[model samples]
Target: MYDYDQVTAFLGKWGPFQRLIFFLLSASIIPNGFNGLSAVFLAGTPEHRCRVPASANLSSEWLNNSIPLEERDGRQVLSRCRRYRLEALAHFSATNLEPGRDVNLSQVEQEKCLDGWEYSREPYLSTIVSEWDLVCDNDWKSPLTTSLFFVGVLFGSFISGQLSDKFGRKNVLFLTMGIQTGFGFLQIFSTSWEMFSILFLIVGMGQISNYVAAFVLGTEILGKSIRIVYCTLGVCIFYAFGYMLLPLCAYFIREWRMLLLALTVPGLLYIPLWWFIPESPRWLLAQGRVQEAEDIIRKAAEKNHVTAPDVIFDPIKVQDLNSQEQQTYSILDLVRTRNIRSITIMCVILWMVISIGYFGLSLDTPNLHGNVYINCFLSAVIEVPAYTISWLLLQYLPRRYSMAAVLFLGGCVLLFIQLVPTYLSVVSITLMMIGKFGITSSFSMVYVYTAELYPTVVRNMGVGASSMASRFGSILSPYFVYLGAYDRFLPYILMGSLTVLTGILTLFLPESYGAPLPDTIEQMLRVKGIKYRSASKSQRRLKYGEENSVILKNTSL
Candidate 1:
């Protein structure tokens, strides 16, 4: 097994730099929050109106004759009749004015007369049938475009994760950022529905890589003590920050395309990631490139004004043997083990439930009765407190209990939304938003918990696969929104039941609060709670020697 003390000592020596990198990687995900609002801009069709100029010779008799006296009262009625007659004359003159002909109007003068009356009305001309109409244009085009973007993300995660492992995290980060920036800029110039769909897909492809790299790189560089917090809560904070920024964009940028362009601008700043971000040393060692890993470590030590230790690199010492011994982790491996199998099954069900209900609720937000802007704003605002609740509960309660409570509460809230009368729709939405907050928190917790359950080698692969599965829920969300044809509550009923079922599954998962992170399949399979099953007598002695060496090294430093 790898020496935890040595790793801890190394982390303590270099923790500050890791923390800084974590913050930057977290900041990188902020732009994705605005994606929820992208449809609003893509479908906007604002109307413009111009009025005709007033004419002095307009007849009042015709307009007065048009108005019925029973609908009129005294001077107020007479004044309205006279004003209407003059406005009618202006409308006629503006439409029919002859330039340089019988009329004395020049082309310029005629145009001015057309602009003469007051500006009348300017309204958005787009169709508004359901709540989805206000949220996004309910055309086949916008939904298809949005779905294509998620599809890109599904593929991009797998591609990016592998590339990061092969090349290095920093390079992938820089490359993905550059690609995302380019695609984001292209999305602004998309004129037709087809063009926008294609651009968004490209954008999603670029964007997915960055997030996967950021999460992996952040966790790899940090100490185990703070790894979960830095990766999970840290990532969640950035996501929430992105959510908060969406409303600000809505308020400032009225034009949809302009708003998208504005959102894309910040991503360009991430280009400098090439120079600042470094490759993960742990990853290098795992690939048996010890010299390169040592060099990187030496450079980091130099930057921190600390001298490099005189030590020989050993592949056997560095490799996470527990992970290597497993060789292959199949679906059967997940279930064949007792505690592990139960955990895997629970995780899968929870992933499905949270994915469906969380996204289902979010997708339906536009249909909720209220100003779309205010409703979105409130929903985002509530997430801050939701995060706080997550932080608090995670510290006090066992992971499963906290997850179950939150999910059950979320389900109850969804049921409440369905049962509430239409007149009390606002109250129902408010409760639904609270439920959404709980579910989102639960979703974040699951990501953290999954990392702790498995050993290191399969960590990225397992998380990536599970995340991709959860994304299926996101993929189905737009279709559910479109399914308002049958009944608006149909999606809600399905999503709510799934969440409750997930909560029940949470009971099956074992508590992992103080358990050592399983390094190998043998350690994972120790159902009798036996200790050190994988290590031989000689290996145990070597482990003690390494622990002593790590203690001596730390003290000398």
Candidate 2:
């Protein structure tokens, strides 16, 4: 019986139908990119000091003296959270009016800011921090806000996968797009941090759920030759494109609310695309709706301008699928088998480490030396070449080596950042970007490698499990960058050390480059001792014994 790829081959690759699907699906990803990192600009904290109240009755001459100066980084700056007692300062001024006298300034008592704080507005006109007065005692709220968004993401990832399988992919995709856009709009009008956090959680759920819907739809429908490009260049590059657009948006629209409103406008454009894209035919076939699946395939053929045979989907293949015993697998199954269990544990660790390092560096872009706008933009810009380099490596290098080498290189660069002289911050920034490039490549490669490593029965679950581990990493990422408050190099040291160790762990996984996708866990175990190479048509037919199932090339997840 002919398979889905065979049906796709008959329709022709790169046709009008395929182009529409790719364009619309890819366009949907751009808004997710903007919302995912909007926290960088929205929660920015600027230089600030205690606000001296009018009741202090201080003249311009006494204004500077109202707030006590403390040593910070070997230089004196006004204390951010404290001010001198007004009565003591007034008495000191009245008693010792002479300049340069031994007034014993240390005797002045300090107190917490009674009035609100004054913020420097040059970098940001306003942010969540400045607007809500989330400073000093409330400073912990900023990172917690970012982490809470990812906590929303964590829950979203868990339920979205199962929901997509039950509901149609197209329906869920559209639903998530609406959820993301609607909640994003609500974030602009939030009156309190609590209100914004709840809205942000809903938006987070929509963010990952939307991505999963698009990813699965693209992987299942596109032709085999074009599937890799769709997953890598089609989906990922557009995400980077949206990322590159983020700093530009934030640069011009300096106000946090307006910037969020601006970022969310693009998602509204995607609502119309619902009419242009089709539901996944593979999903229809899996549900035993062969006639509906065939109808869509025929529609694709018509749009591709190819003539399709009257008999499109083979009945025998559908019957075989229906007749096959339904087997159930769970997360425990991943750890139940000995060999699969080992691979699963390693993958989970690898994903978690990669995510923490990737996101830690991404969120820390604002802290890097230079203009925050330029630094954030450069952080996004570096991914362009990194993706290009990754594309080249996927063609020539083994998956295990390429993944490990990039991780190790990125880790080494991060470790070296600690040694750069503090004055040479530009040098340090450059090294961090280099490390980001390496981690970016590893991040891109891991999705494909993990998909290839797992069998068909548990492929979605395996990828989902690893992705869930990644959410935990993302939840912790803000805190990792938060470590900079204690010491500038702490974030880098932790990220680098974890990356280096995980890089070594990656070497033990079997190489998937040029390998056939295993259909079962037993087949995957046998692959360890096997040498995989590209095969001719005759060899593929002989290998799979062409009674029905086809030996197709592996596609990226």
Per lDDT, the best of the predicted structures is 2
Cα-based TM-score, every candidate: 0.72, 0.91
lDDT of 2 at 184: 92
Instruction: Please report how far candidate 2 places residue 61 from its true position, in Å.
Output: 3.4
Query: After superposition on all CA atoms, what RMSD does each candidate show versus the true structure?
Result: 12.9, 7.4
lDDT of 1 by residue, 1-557 (tens): 57533643543534556566777778877876666435543443222222323234433433222222212211222111112233443454446643235333211211122222222122222311121222222345545555677777777876997899898887887788777778878877765566767877877877778778887887877667667676657777787788778767766665555677787788877777656677887887777777887776666665555655675345567765524665666555656556555556566667767877766666566666666566766767776677777877777778778888988888778777777877786787878887888788898788767766665656655565568777676666666665653476766677777788888777656566667777765565232232334668999999999999999999999
lDDT of 2 by residue, 284-311 (tens): 8888888888889888888988898988
Stretches of candidate 2 exceeding 4 Å from the true structure: 71-75, 94-100, 314-320, 525-557
CA lDDT of each prediction against the hidden true structure: 0.64, 0.86
Deviation (Å) of 85 in candidate 2: 2.9
Candidate 1 structure, TM-score to reference: 0.72
TM-score of 2: 0.91
Give the range where candidate 1 is weakest over 10 consecutive residues by summed lDDT.
73-82
